[model samples]
Target: MKRIFKLRSELVFSAAISAIIAIIFAIILKEFILGSFLNNSKNTTEYVHDDVIAAIEYQLKNMNINDSNKVQKYMDKENSMLYLISIVHKDGKVIASNNKEIKSIDANEVVDGKKTFKFLNDNRKNLVKITRCDYLKDGCYLYYIYVGYGKLENENIVGIMTGIIFIIIFFLIIWKRISYISEIKSTVRSIAKGNLYERVPLKYKNELRELSEDINYMTSEMEKEDKKRSEFLTNISHDLRTPLTTILGYINMIKNGKYVSKDELNSYVDIMNKKSLYLKNILDDFFQYSKLSSKDIVLEKQKIELNELARQIVQEEEDEFIKNNLTLSINLMQEFIYIYVDPNLFLRAVNNLLSNALKYSKHNTSVEFNISKEKYNNKFYAIISASNIPEEPITDDEIENFFERLYKKDLSRQKEGSGLGLSIVKDIIKLHSGFVKTYKENNRLFFKIYMDIKF
Candidate 1:
């Protein structure tokens, strides 16, 4: 047996099925009504024919056998009274028929002690009535009275069957509609219960499909915003703690008068200044991150030669590199690699990368800049990479989390700088429709930036 449908709260699947069943029942009822009407018509026609034949037989009994004009007048009058009636004789001859189509009746076929009565043809194509009577006083003379109406066709049956089939088809359609609605409701309920990934299994591009797609899109957006907010809170808490610790340390030093000598006092003041600057940077990073989250930052995009930009940033940081006794090297191809970007923001991002490299790199290790172009998917990309040998080998997991805001692998090195440098770099790259990633290979920390030239 086929599975029957189930009802659900959200969808009207069962109601739709019931509606279809009702329609089918109504169609069947209509067919039955028409069948009843046809059957009544057939019965009435048979009754009228029987009555006409009986009346003709009574008139014949009262008439004189020798009077031919009286018998003819009675037959003609009976024929005029019923249009479908016909009379036939015992010798297989049609004597008087209102319709010329009817043939003679056989009087040997008896029904209820009568030699002839009403009957249906072999194919039920015609209705017939037969009667037997003695016109003369002697029993040797026999006369057959044959009366026939018209045939009852099967057109009514055909119409009823058609109505039944239509009702079944209509019910099937309603059942399917109800099933679809139930599925939609089930999916919606699942989504309402915090199942952000829930979706309706819709196959067609109809109104239901569009509605399901819109709901899925909305859930995805809400999940993304929720994730960003959680990450923002975690990053803010971690980043703010480092600066506060440094500031508290400096204030403790001043309160204790630990810097008695002039040189010691100057060093303490320098430490305070650095700590204050670090706090200011952290505040700035927070503002920038908020702006990015709110979609407030706009890119001032323009074509820029990456080689020239790298060289200029490198030159600007030459003093710091030297002061830290770091060796820096630049490898640039002769061909100009141009990319559309916000120059100022791009410079800041590059500066952040270089600063990170300088701060984390072991003293006297070579920091290398390699600029090149990569072709992929029939599109050109400008790649700027910076790498330096770290004091210790960084782990793969650390590299994966390098761009996460305020994430630090070495907790002891927190005093060196604010931890939002790589986060800012990531935001800037995203703004340019580009990407940034970090990796550790051969005891060297590598940061690669990719910018699409085609966009």
Candidate 2:
């Protein structure tokens, strides 16, 4: 039964059932009020009839039928004493009545040896009481009365009915609102279960609308992340296979003695050695990234001058820079800029940055560096920035993701990198409580490092 209906429809139906039950209860209550009013009216009519009978019996004992003055006094007293009453003659004529139209008694029927009381207004169908009485000697004198009372009034019963109908309409509106929310929740659940395209209908401007928009945003982000993961796996597999294939091909050639010349054999052995080192580098990157991800790398902190550290890293890479025909520039603050950091990890970060600059920069292009101080909110920061002229400028978006594990900006340049150097640099900086960012300006890639000087 639950599966037979859509979630939205099921919610509406349940609400409708609740509304129907409430309406039924309300109707029953209205009927109960009407019934109670009818009963009270009957009681009032009986009490008034008894009073009239006692008055008539007293009049018969104390006054003659011809005494007009005495009868007029009695009529005034009865009018003041009863809720609603009337007197009529057997000739179908009215003598006195609380309501004028009720004065005429129908002669065709009799009740207790008197003419029957009939309702003068045909519209008042639920009149609860009608009583008749005889007082005169010829059975010509009759007392007639009718009374009605209830929660309903002639004018306001329409209003009451209108209110009841409005209640029903309000229930339906609530049901519809709830059903819409239910549908949205169901759609979100479906999306969470791997239906990437599942979406809620934008039917109204309410919480549900905002919720649907949030879900759509989340799903889009998830899809992007999934695509990145897939690409990362494919890139890793390719990197691994290329080195293994080279090593295997070279070993088979050596085993079959395909290189007859001593120089050719040495060259082949060198090639094999380079390919093995490349494979080892890739594996090492994977291990390092995995360790950083799990937060297993611990840092031993020490106070050191950042400018000195930068000079040392540049000196270490001087030979490689010269071999590659790349120009290295170093800028250091005149005063010592001291910071607390792990020296080895900090050097690794600076080294990785310099290595990346070397790998991406064009031959004979100068890589520039600036070591300076930036102040914000009365706090001083040691800022290290490096810029290199690359063969092609990287996009702003790609630069922001430079430190993501196994992320390569240009797949065609896969041979130049293991895609983990920048990631390691980022992790090391984070361990030192520093921040790093990259940007591209005027066809030159810029890397910025920020570290607190005071702490």
| Top candidate when judged by lDDT against the true structure | 2
- Could you tell me every candidate's TM-score relative to the true structure? 0.57, 0.65
Candidate 2 per-residue C-alpha lDDT over 323-372 given as tens digits, one digit per residue, 9 for 90 to 100:
88988988889998988888877877787888888888888898887788
**lDDT, model 1:** 0.67
Model 1, range 354-427, lDDT digits (tens) per residue? Answer: 98898888988889988998775687779999999987678778888799766666775554555778888999
Once superposed on the true structure, which residue ranges of model 2 sit more than 4 Å away at CA? 1-168, 295-299, 376-378, 395-406, 427-431
The per-prediction tally of clashing pairs is 2, 0
lDDT of 1 at 391: 77
Judge candidate 2 at residue 181 and give its lDDT: 75
